[model samples]
Target chain A: MDFFKRQLPTLLVLVLGLGMIIQYYIPTTFSQQVLKNVNLWIQIIAAFTLCIGITSLLRTHYTKIRLQHSGWAYSIILYIVFIAMVILGFYRGIQEGTPFRWLFDYVQTPLSSTTFSLTAFFICSAAYRAFRARTMEATIMLIAAIIVMIGRIPFGDMLSAYLPSFIPGFNDMAGWIFNTPGMAARRAILLGISLGGIATSLRIILGIERSYQGKD
Target chain B: MGIIQKVLNVDRRVIYLIVFLAVAIPIIFPLNLPVTLTEEVMGVYNEIENLPEGSPILIAVDYEPSSSPELNPMTRAILKHCFKKNLRVVTTTIWPTDGSGGSIADKLVEEEARIAGKIRGKDFVNLGFKTGSYAVVIGMGEDFKKTFPKDFNGNVLDKLEILNGTHSNGNSESSLPNAAFSQDARAKKINSLKDFSYMVCIHDDSSVFTWITYGYERYGIKIGTGCTAVMAPGNYPSLQAKQITGIIGGLKGASEYEKLMNYRGEGARGMDSQSVIHVFIIILIFLGNLTYFILERKKTVRG
Candidate 1:
């Protein structure tokens, strides 16, 4: 009984996985129905998962505030803003000309912009400190990155102007790097990732891994 | 400290300012660079082109404002194609926070539909933000009406003319009342994934891959994805294996798609900035490497 109980979830996952895989080749009416039902179930489960993630985030912050932890003050602020956003979003729609819209327009959008904009800062700092040209590979990568950057910006043209007129098509060269070499590198990474993803997913379905059960 | 050390330890704020300028100046004064269309992008285009005009296609927007720069343009381009093809579009978003992102797509299609004199409830419908994630997407494949239950305005499903054969499926010849749309539509159209002709997912998240596996593997419906540039490369193998028909990565993909559709929208404009910015990043990487090489050589000599 214990073994069955432990293995039940994995077994069900496998059966569903196999069923889904089989449904692809056979173009029968019944197979289509099964696929639809499976998709619906996935959507339902995913929706529930979203709530769980958001709730946990709230719980962690709120608990910190309650306990008055060393950084509890920041937690309190986070919780307040989070809860306020939720209330405004759910209770009052952020329709045009509404107070919720104001909150969304002024607070949410700006804050989001600010957050993403900080990526530029972090990228530069990391580049300065971590992007060492210690090896041939590193040196090549650094050169590619810099050429691509200059080729992109107005400064590239300005810098090129100072160079002897013989170095033609500096901007075009940068575009070529992105469109060709950069694309090739990115594609290679994607191919590796996809293979890894397929392997990982298959492993989970075949019961080769049970870490999701928290006993790993 | 030392003179060289002080030079290397330039103010962190200065770095931020430089990066800000790199990303900002391009936005302010866009470039008119040429954009080359890759086979990957063309693959996505060809897949949509081959589908029958009136085929029902599910368009899922699975991202939010945070990823708008990359995703929004892709979504718009897909919407343009679906609408132009006179394809029956079922637009839905997995995340509620991405309602605005969906709105961006919605507004574009609506404007186009209006210009072309197409009615909403009849020709196309915005299913809006559904609460479920992968479940909702899966459920949609099974039974769109059951999963959505209502349109964005909360109108009851049975009443909607779009589902119940109230409107003819684009081609006047297929005007047969959609008896398939009744509650039985779920049971009939979806059992496994083969019921739909194609599914277009514009997302930045990973879980959407389940749709490719579960939907494509089971149903035989071709899957195409549009994702942020960062997420694009990861889908390459899937494309290579032909599990996914095609992918549009980042703003550039969106721009190419937009041009293909003959609809020059935000995507086309965004490309000018994207191209310039990409070149800027390449230069920064080069400078950093050059500085490192020089400094390393000096250190080695001293040693």
Candidate 2:
């Protein structure tokens, strides 16, 4: 039972991981077929996993409701909406001109848009609190942010048009910041992330990372 | 309380109100500020323009409703361009079809195709939302039909005249359509991701990187992307790396694409509002800092 629970899974991962690495280099028809089949299996499994996820979410909320947890009313609302949406989806399908489509177009879309739009308000308040130039680094960050913000808009170009010729344009300065310093910083981060991903992948393949196997 | 204290402790609701007014006033009125096209946006325009007519182009719409406001205009503009150029479009969404993203793509494609007087399944097809994001992309590179056997409408690919030569049972080596004899061009079938002349991915998240890595890196396909303003900066490294051919970033980028198309749309109209909000936020930042410094100075003096 221990072997079935642990050793078998690890063995499968080791074999599949090595096979995938090998398949990338050798592009033979057999290797290509293996990759194709594996991808198809992933798609099928992903579809099933989505259902599992939905079930897990429902179960979690249901437990909260049953236990009468604080803010349990929100769970009720979630259940109501979830059931409504699922029924609508199954009943009419997602085709054009259905109640399902109408619910999505009207309720879900506006709710989502409103939620996302609220971030602008919060960002405004947050920036007001955060952009104070208390230190040299903060001041530099504030200045660069201001420049990039102004330069991205059409008003900046209009303002630049009225400015003197000797001074560089807001757009030009902004472009320089983005192209040189921004790109360099981003590439450095990407390189670090890539190296980290490689290291982690190797650990997972070698079964050194057993976190995904869950607690004993 | 002193003026500095009042300014420093201004109600957040007031800030929200001010932002709302700033965004709303410009939209209600008219500024019609001229938007200068950036090189990145122009790159996307030029690539689509330069593609031969009747060439198949894959468009992956990978954003949900929250980002629809920013990404929808881009999707519409790109579709309009593809149809205007007489290119074949195959659209799929990595985001769930049961969600609003799939419907948005379907409606936008239908609207644009109707405007262009293009026929369904011939000029354009929506393969709808598929599960397995990166895996789906990689699978499409190997075998397109295996990735999507049926489109959103449940129509079989084998029956679609647009995908005539794409079937395994048919002539596999036909050349793509040319402008002169496009009607009879038997070669305009897309069997895999490599078969497409170009690919566009309009997303609100980091899924564009997936397309770059899986679709472009693996198959050597040229790809362009559109992302929300917040996600745009993250794409700069990939853009500099030339992993992506071009980018249309946020509503601003959408407006640029509209300007290049010579068709004024919602994106162009929203620029004035966007400009006003940005300036308003900058002003708030300045005022906040000014008050903070004044208070600090007063405290130091008292000490």
Tens digits of per-residue lDDT, candidate 2, A50-158, equal 8998999999999999999999999999999888978888888877888988888898877898899889899899988777898998999899998988888898898
What is the C-alpha lDDT profile of model 2 across B1-303, one tens digit per residue? 987898888899999998898778877786888989999998788888878667788888888888888788888999999887777888888877436437878878899989988888887888888888889899889998878899887799768877764312122332434455443333667788888889899988778888888999999889998988878878888888898878898988998999888877878777788888889889988998989989889999999
TM-score of chain B of each: 0.81, 0.92
User: For every model shown, what is its TM-score relative to the native structure?
Assistant: 0.73, 0.95
Candidate 1, RMSD to the unseen true structure: 6.6
Q: Give the DockQ (2 decimals) of all models.
A: 0.29, 0.76
Deviation from native of the Cα of residue A58 in model 2, angstroms:
1.0
Candidate 1, B1-303: lDDT as tens digits = 655455567687877676677667766776554455667788888877766555666777777666776677777778777666656566667666764424534544566667656677776666677665556555655665677777664567656665554444445344234323322332233222355567887887774576776567645678898988767756766776788888888777887788788765666677666555455455555565556567778899999
Write model 1 residue lDDT over A120-170, tens digit each, in one string: 578767776678777889777767767755654345666777777776545
lDDT of 2 at B247: 84
